[model samples]
Target: MEPLDKEQQLERLYATPPVYEWELIVNPMHFRTKFACLLSLTFTFIGVGIFILLPSLKGLMIASSPIIVGSLMYPWSRYLLNADKRHYYAINKYGMYSTSEQIIPEIAYTIVRRSAWVGCAICVFAAIFIGPIAFVGAGGAALMSFTMTNFRSVPHKSQCLFDGYAKLRNYRENEYSLYTEYYHYGFDLMIPESKLMSIIGVIKQYNDTFEEEFVDLYKDSKFQARPIILEIVR
Candidate 1:
């Protein structure tokens, strides 16, 4: 789907947010997630190899690839392909919040961006020395991104429009995610399919109905002078 423009993004804010709470699970077995992890470990291995064979500025980048990839990419991969742990979350006017259905809620955060750089970083480094390897790595990253985007779950608030990016998909049963704000303190709502259409309609109508009222409030706010009267009551 095409990306939401600013107006649509704002309109989405009008929906009462749905909160999804599930036990945190980063299932690394999914093909796309595993592929991302494989790319990460591969670069880490190459970095280690460079550090062992030719330790220098060039070798340092190869070696540091692990940290860069580990910090930046692994977390992202796990989030995109998180496990379906059983939990409960609720949404209200204040914010989307969750409570742990289990004793421990360990998920920390979800990544919104696919860190393709992790896959290609090594390739670029290799280009400085081994051109062919870079091409292979870049190609793999491009391929991985295709799968990654298919299952990607961008983060949304508890009260978000039910259509577009916030819409839940039960077909795969894996394209939803969550982050631990504290132990069971945040929400990752997975709306039911049966109710999805009605909820979307209700929210859209509410937003549309109030569009003029909210936008034109300032236009009708012109002040009128009147005789001043002051009263004091004790």
Candidate 2:
């Protein structure tokens, strides 16, 4: 085999760092529990308020409101849960087998903005209802909103090796890409697809040794002048 270059050495170090046991995180945000609480509490309060206070509904809200609110909230919760599952699975279970190289800034922006706006709208509507029951429902909506906005579990929870950077794939076209938070310039190393097991070591080594070098190298560089590369490791 050809001797590895300095960059290759660094990449290898990151992909296969020494470790005892890989940490597996499931349900990192506790969203499953959070959603359950939200649904249960919102319906519980509404059920009681409508059945006892109004009495005309005759516990109708308990039976029917759940279906209505559930129809609206379930889809949102399902989407949020799926997003969380994808992220956690990648980091904790799959161990970064393959990653897209294009550090698309637009993708992150769109995801964040859309999620935020949707969450904010739900919370705002709940807030406007205005009553003790409204307060409880609004609280549930607000929690869901905050959770959805910050749903990605890996980076936020400090599991990834490098912090990522956002790049414009196409400025006028609005295409974008994402990069490791601290990456070296002129040294794009995409791990081979068949070498999936090596990624854990690679990430571990990269974080342990060269994280500082990677960050310092491009910390002051002009954004318009950065080379983008992606790695697809086994």
Candidate 3:
């Protein structure tokens, strides 16, 4: 038989009705406060130092632009990206499929507006020090930064399909999440504690090679580490 193409494979996978399905609403502020504070403080210091060194009205605007934009946009972006959004997942005989709701237009607008402001700040800073010629270099840098941001911001896969046969190991990381790896890819499943075992049972039915073992999720030590044993207790 001829090899199936990407579209065909996806069609075949989706044709199988899901045995189980679930949804999760992620907390926008989950484990992010400390990191956000550190980021904001570092930018604040930079802006302050720039103002002190230049000591002018123009310097004030140039320096404060990023700080102002970052302060407002970071939280707004996070909320827009995650608030009220539901991640959907389904499992069948072939594999598991997952997707999340997103506000594409709002997300794109925020990213573009923030990147433009930061780019303008860079251009102004450069022009003050290096004259008209600096605009060329600064403009190039800004474009490069914008391109890199867009590249990173775009989601590579709208829906992720994980093949059951390809799964290598599964680790339970508390009541809310499960971590799994296969070959070069690793994924986290946001499954409720109550439904976790049932989902595993469905997967095991399709994948005969399924095996449970203890392994360190995080390798904190090179010489010695305690491994967490993962198994289904009847």
Say which candidate scores most in lDDT.
Answer: 3
User: How large is the C-alpha RMSD of every model relative to the true structure?
Assistant: 20.3, 16.1, 7.1
Residue-wise C-alpha lDDT for candidate 1, range 128-148, written one tens digit per residue = 774454343234443454344
TM-score of 2: 0.30
Given candidate 1, what's the lDDT at residue 173? 32
Clashes of 3: 0
Question: Ten-residue segment with the worst summed lDDT in candidate 2?
Answer: 167-176
Off by over 4 Å in 3: 1-7, 73-85, 101-184, 219-234
lDDT of each: 0.40, 0.38, 0.53
| TM-score, ranked from best to worst | 3, 2, 1
lDDT of each residue in 128-181, candidate 2, tens digit only? 543345434345445555665654434432122243332212221111122354
Backbone clashes for every candidate come to: 6, 25, 0
Candidate 3's TM-score reads: 0.63
As a whole number from 0 to 100, the lDDT of residue 210 in candidate 1 is 16
For model 1, what is the alpha-carbon lDDT of residue 44? Answer: 58
- Return the lDDT, model 2, position 89: 15
